[model samples]
Target chain A: MKDLDGLDLPTFEDVIAAHARIAPHIRRTPVLVSEALNALTGAELFFKCENFQEAGAFKVRGACNAVFGLDDEQAKLGVATHSSGNHALSLSYAAGRRGIPCTVVMPRTAPQAKKDAVIGYGGRIVECEPSTSSREATFARVQEETGAEFVHPYNDPRVIAGQGTCSRELAEQVEGLDAVIAPIGGGGMISGCCLTLSTIAPHIKIYAAEPEQADDAYRSFKAGHIIADDAPDTIADGLKVPLKDRTWHFVSNHVTDILTCSEQEIIDAMKLTFKRLRVVMEPSCAPPLAAILKNPEVFRGKRVGVIITGGNVDLDRLPWIKG
Target chain B: MKDLDGLDLPTFEDVIAAHARIAPHIRRTPVLVSEALNALTGAELFFKCENFQEAGAFKVRGACNAVFGLDDEQAKLGVATHSSGNHALSLSYAAGRRGIPCTVVMPRTAPQAKKDAVIGYGGRIVECEPSTSSREATFARVQEETGAEFVHPYNDPRVIAGQGTCSRELAEQVEGLDAVIAPIGGGGMISGCCLTLSTIAPHIKIYAAEPEQADDAYRSFKAGHIIADDAPDTIADGLKVPLKDRTWHFVSNHVTDILTCSEQEIIDAMKLTFKRLRVVMEPSCAPPLAAILKNPEVFRGKRVGVIITGGNVDLDRLPWIKG
Candidate 1:
């Protein structure tokens, strides 16, 4: 843990500055409550809807903060990221807003719709083999070739600080929240919640929900150290990545517990969310709600804030329907 | 025109009263704007999201007003209605809220999901043949037996007043809107918009959108009279019903025009709304957006308010997907 001392971990003040930096580009996304979901969970739940974000995810908040915070010289070189999902689209959107170039290093095998969306947002694509080493190698090459700032999807301090803005808004929107939960992958969003709520609303307990198939964060929490998983698969594809040092610092210290749910539970929770909340969100956003529904005793009678992280999904292949 | 002298029409004052009366029951549904949509349509569109209403449709506003407006004696008998769609579900919801019995006379062939939802809201369903005459006869018999006060879905003054509150909210939520558009489905929502906008902001033009497959309202507006259609088939099933006298009174007088789009256009607009707005609205909500897209010259450089009327749809049968 002492190794973190030299790393520039973001503080609450950084979160405040990040909020100010990205306020113009990001939405103060609405908080929605459902009587039916409340009755079913035995908890009063407040859903912070980042799905309605212009870039269709909470990732845009971090992307905008990173893009807009760049000084004139750095901004001229532009920003780059390796992602096949919302992060790619969000970063492209943010860079486009600042009139800077965005280069995405994505797998050559990625869906055409996703590639088209990134290009639609004015991002240049650099194709890579669909593997961890290949993606990292391609990303490094792209950064070296272009001298562009590499924006890690969730690991960067700036990204965590920007993500903290969501919980800050959630706390302001809903008073007396006894707990807050979010789906955790690389822990950018959870780290942000930890950073913000620990400073401003320490009484509120923070929890991270993960897909059972990709429960490295849960294992890490139990073993009192970081646990890395290689290519663990789950329908909640956004959560397949491993947590890094900067995110691990917040997850270890502030998060009260890490919870996991089965894939079927996630799908059920997703369908229920669509039916009850009447919002279209992706699979990654379902784990928190699934955890709550699966272990109602943990959330019962508490005022809980659930982060619906993103809404980017293929409408044709909704998970609940048979292929 | 003189025939309307004896008919009771809801006024702006009634809209105010209805707002106050149903304020506790209904949400001040948020207005959403999409920059992507704006870029495509060339209009600054403000979407009034009644789809986010607790009962999943704007019909809840009207239903709540009717159910809550009943006096103690009338409440004792409860409420009755004949509908095969949102009104049946909405009235059931409102009646359940009021702790009153709700009897719905629905077609025997209506989807089981629809029937289950109505029953879930504590409504009693009396099924009849899936025809206008059989539905009316069944409704008449049920009303006679139960002594429940009948609530006409769109043609009643109370319902019109309740629906007007949606536009009242929109008018307050947005500034300097040049025009407001909503799909014409028996004209309940559009009539309500006309009622509220005519009194509060008459300068704002009111446009009704209709599917070409069931363009009776458009024909009626052009013909300068009410034109009733019998059992027209369209993907926008909600708009197949013809406008009644009460709604026609508003459409013939206050509505600026009724625009029509083909069935394919409606389906395309529905997909675009889901993709751009990240919302789960039904096909009935698509016509207004379709009309706007098809006639871009009409809405370009204008601030347009689009009423997304409902979100209740079968996920398995999305219009854009091949069956």
Candidate 2:
């Protein structure tokens, strides 16, 4: 099945196929439930701990699917992306495992640690200006020169199908979830959740959690169209990207609600999660708990599945522990 | 089985009974392994994650056993302990769950966060001096006045039996571990490991790790007697206590070796574990990794089980983040 945007939207079958293809590469992250967190939120919360996934995020699932699904000819050309975070690292990780080249077009201002991570995973870096136009232009040039297939961080069908495996596994691991919540950046993970749940467990409501400081997805949902943002500064750095065509399809078609929480609320939720759950995650992943805390009425008695999207964090730069 | 001190040392049968008795009260924490950490150490390290235990430590197992194992009349008097860390919080947690009054005699200099945790868990705090003499004196007065049962942190047989359940679970979780290493504080966890492994998996080596700043366990192990220290200081605050008689018997008889690591080495190992495992563990839990890293030859090519003792830390005071 293809969306109206002419992109091939992978079905539940495709997600199943992706899971089988990438099962050997990606991690089957455990579902951790904390009685303390459940008591605090007044909800039965099941945390899908993708923070323990390879490359430290669920993106590795999609990256592995895309890399491993490629035919020999296409695989020889390799994979490329414009992400500066976990996606880039994951793609690099996947491509390295397959013995193929991976190129990352990152802004020159990207953190040195992230750059080193990409390099550590055998990724070639193509530095661009700190702007979307510059990033796209550089990515185009790199793809053209290297003949590398461009994998949009969230918009590709294979990537979406790969991410959908998380929810499929969640359904098998946990029974009778009233709703599922995942952070919406470019809407990849939430889209994957929607794709999986809408087909396998259609009774389950799908919710999108977004940082209020970078509320592009929230605003887009209300406006009934896509709202593209260039460079919004938020502590949830992974969530600054705007919704693209493929993700907008899932959000518009299946999502029940889009919730937003303030930056302070997200940080508080992150700390509370660490204290209660004993798991370290990036700020972008805390928006689900933030939304739950802010609008408890929406989720008060529900058995909610929260996808902890990632755990890549700078230990020296905790938001609460200020310099 | 009773020891020379007339303490009825709980046998492997008692550990099995304790597991059945305390199963409902405590969490069966998951065993997590990090391939990154394994690669770094050149050993297959299975981390028995007690940090995720209720009340945020493995001490909850013993605390729950002691609190719940009591008969009705004895339970009416409640429980009391003289400690300033995980033991206090865990005992308070257990007591709170069982609807019993618990008293803790803590040093006046203990961190406010730890004190708050005990109070939050419904424990009454009696402030004492920093020395063991002052602590014991204050605890004696409190126990005499309240008629509460004195559940000595590591000296009691029930406590050792309670902790022994961790190694029992580890033995079931992972097969063919060449050795097991746990941080030695007052030697509760190590003694428990010794008690369990020495009985069932007698071939497996038992190693006790200690911080160099608080090397009473190391010194005592070599001296062939209990060497009580008065308020040793280390970043691993949970391990500052000295060895007691009940723990000394197990350590002197069953332990294969006692290893020590410097303060900075412990902090570095803690940071590395956080980075690689994405689990927030306390400094007291890092000595095993420090020992592994400092002496790779001792652990390389072997399958080792490292017990993560706790995760209760003052997040505001992370060592890597300079003030």
Q: By lDDT, who's the top model here? A: 1
Report the lDDT tens digits of candidate 1 across residue range B1-323.
12357888888888888999988888999999898899999899999988899789999999999999999899999999999899999999999999999999998999999999999899999999988789889989999998999999999999999999999999999999999999997999999999899988999999999999999999988988888887688999999989888999999989988899999999999998888898889999999999999999899999999999998898878877776
User: With candidate 1 superimposed using the best TM-score fit, by how many Å does residue B60's alpha carbon deviate from the native?
Assistant: 1.4
Q: Pick the candidate with the highest DockQ.
A: 2
Q: Write the per-residue lDDT of candidate 2 for residues B1-323, one digit (tens) a residue.
A: 55566666778888998899999988788888887788889999999999999989999999998999999898999999988889999999999999999999999998898899899899999999987689878988998899999888888889999999999999999999999999998999999999899999999999989999999999998989988787789999889888888888899999999999999999999999888899989999999999999989999999999999998887878888886
Model 1 chain B scores worst on lDDT over the 10 consecutive residues at B1-10
Model 1 spans with C-alpha error above 4 angstroms: A1-3, B1-3
Candidate 1 Cα deviation (angstroms), residue A58: 0.8
- Candidate 1 clashes between residue pairs 3 or more apart in a chain or in different chains: none
Worst 10-residue stretch by lDDT in candidate 2 chain B?
A: B1-10
Writing each residue's lDDT as its tens digit, candidate 2 over A137-203 gives 9999999998998887889999999999999999999999999999999988988998999999999
C-alpha positional error of residue A21 in candidate 2 after TM-score superposition, expressed in Å: 1.1
